[model samples]
Target: MSTRQEEATWTTLETFDVEVSSPSNRLYRNGRQQVEVTVKLRARNEDGRIVPLSEEQKRSVRLIDYNSGEVLPDIPASGTVATGWGTTSVRNEYEFFPGARDGMPGQIGPAEGYTFVVRYVQTVDAAPKRIGAQVRRDAQTVFKTNADNVQKSIEAVPERLPSFDERATSVEHGWESQRVVGDENDWDLRTVDYYFCGLSINGNRVKLREFTVRPASMFQWESTNPASEIFSFTGFGTPGSSMAQYNVPAAFSDRRHNPISMPSDGRGIVVLIRSNGIAQSSAGNVHKGACDVDARDEFGTDHPLRVSFKSSSNRNELVLTRR
Candidate 1:
């Protein structure tokens, strides 16, 4: 008896708000540049209506970059795309491929696309110029430039990270939602999810990479009566084979039985990697790539904290603080 082959039937579940975010395409040099665009998606029903997404339906969001009347590669096909979400929306990251290596004229350029769920990506390049004067023998030379002229690669929009005082914004709130909870020895964590969209550069013409669903942060947490606490946290793991990589330094500024308090209290310590050699002025702040935890007790001693609990996989890496 011959067995019959079964044809797979695809179904539509739901659709909702989708958006793409990326830095402007104002490059300064003529080399390869990578700028990430985040794609966020919501669940929909068969009628293409908004609905709550079940845990199983959680996936990545697709993205595309339309430039000069042409479509870039690594864009999504059909189906429900995967994405990462904070308490409010999905936070995805897309990288632009290489092109001009040089800069674009200090002005806006055209780039747009759509999400698989019928949500769209409306994007434009905005480059603001800078002005300065150089002292000369007889007269002063004035220079007018912008981020586009300062660097040959695409720079992150909102060049500055969210300030501690700017806690009212969605990004800052998302960070708060993911704050660690519980004792340092035994911890619990919440992570921000992001959907991978696409990669492209400011002046480039080709697409380099593609991705879908991923967690914004990988860690553990716990909760208390008044508020929650973060006992341990590790940065997002690197892709198996990709152009992007983040290394957390083994050494830190402070290390001891550091207690992480809630959002309102400004007593918790923070851990991050800082290449610029600058310290943040605010209190009760934590940054992964830029600032590591300032571990210390009431007495103020220097020690290297160790990871008491660790669980990592292809998707995430976690490190718990020692008490």
Candidate 2:
């Protein structure tokens, strides 16, 4: 909140007049900010000397909600303090918050002007008899400006599983798991981003990109355990050299995982890949992957697909082969 002193209004009564002012005239449309309205009670004796309300007068003073037309009490404030000459006063405070009328994040339109008012009155009444006086009042026009108001802050990072385990001594070199119908909910991919973490096969880190974190669907449930696919990478930085690895979140043998797919956009998601508020890392490596796991188009066959050379036909066609 940019706490700037704003102009307020004043209402004078017989003995004491209420001084009203706000800490700000501009606020955010999010309605999270509260404008502090300070109310100070001032008194003047017949000798033209400023004085304080008596103990009885202090207790007698009341507060009213001018906006809702209702009387209020015990409004939080800087409790009464002695100024000088035994003349002291209490400073009462109130807040006026503004918000979006549409109630949605992008629904609310451009900047809008608004007016919120609050008033107070001192009153003492007895059965069938009443005496009321104004203590303090505020009727100021405040604006709900565009949201360049509040300070920017980073909340927290999204939770995700780590890419490596410290206890594991060696990589398991084996082809163990079978391809079976997997649970539609098991999207084992890098959902959160790893900044500057050298998880890339090329010794460089890549951003995972943020997306919508959605819950896996139960309707597509097929099995508790899903099958995993194995992929091998070959021919990079070596003369006629090659390497292969299966794309599995667990050990190379822990292949009981269902394949899941999620849209790059936020609309519909399949029982595959967890879009944990971010685009997950590609199946094999962040950049490189087995060509067999993902299909390709002529020249646009992502650079990773080039590593495997699964199909050399420069045609934008789909072929199905059942082994």
Candidate 3:
């Protein structure tokens, strides 16, 4: 016996309505974040009353690029099926990211706009046959610069420093006579400083607000210089909450003012550091330590600076080298 196949007919679903909603219309040009677009379909009969979508109708739903009229195969989507039989509407969500193609990073697209559409095909059953219908709605999203657009970094004037020995003098006595011998460098204490520089939109300087310093386990903030006429140190001797607050200079021309206006040459701000007073055993012995600098700009963007340094454990020995 031979079987015959007949062609199925499709009809226009005029009564059905689709609504598209996008939570955010903006995306970061750097492709660091994504925007969620949701589409909802409301099925209605000729009488204008809401009705549930059939399984075949839900299965035919797809998200497409409106400009190209092609299905979006890469954007992740969900909710093609209704939650329950009595549900009058079905919805789908698409996660759209900048520079993403087929769910992977491709060439960064132009910083412009894009349009996407949610399409649904409804299938209707007729006597001995079935009919297909389609409906669609579109959503638009645009790209913008990343929120933290100002480039942030730190340049240590001298990447390496010499730690001096604090105990350079020794005492010896012979019942009747005594002599003292040791190297007198007179410079047992030192400070390491760093400068900050970066540009904002249109080559503008970043206005620094504050500085937070977090020392490593082998190091601690120097407690000797607790306060200065230009700035005050808080949480000194405590690595966790160490911070420096600047006193608004009485005049911008004051040479002792804290560098708050970052310069293109990185000569604006100076982050000061001193040893925590951990002794070393032998001469030429080197100890390494580091601290993290968190700087807040005028835009309230936090820039991180990782600083590394070296020191000597021998007493009264100057290990820091100047540039």
**TM-score to native of every candidate shown:** 0.17, 0.23, 0.27
How far out, in Å, is residue 46 in model 1?
4.9
What are the lDDT figures for the candidates, one per model? 0.23, 0.22, 0.27
- Looking at candidate 3, the ten consecutive residues that score lowest on lDDT are 153-162
Which one wins on TM-score? 3
In candidate 3 the C-alpha lDDT for residue 45 amounts to: 41
What candidate 1 gets wrong by more than 4 Å, as runs, is: 1-25, 28-31, 46-60, 65-71, 74-323
How displaced is residue 167 in candidate 1, in Å? 32
Provide the lowest-lDDT 10-residue window in model 2: 192-201
What's the number of clashes in each of the models?
Answer: 63, 13, 11
Best by lDDT: 3
Candidate 1 per-residue lDDT over residues 119-146, each given as its tens digit: 2221211222111111111113111112
Which portions of model 2 miss their true places by more than 4 Å?
Answer: 1-20, 26-32, 45-49, 54-69, 72-225, 229-323
Q: Of the pair 2 and 3, which is ahead by TM-score?
A: 3
- Superposition TM-score, candidate 1 onto the true structure: 0.17
Q: Quote model 2's TM-score.
A: 0.23
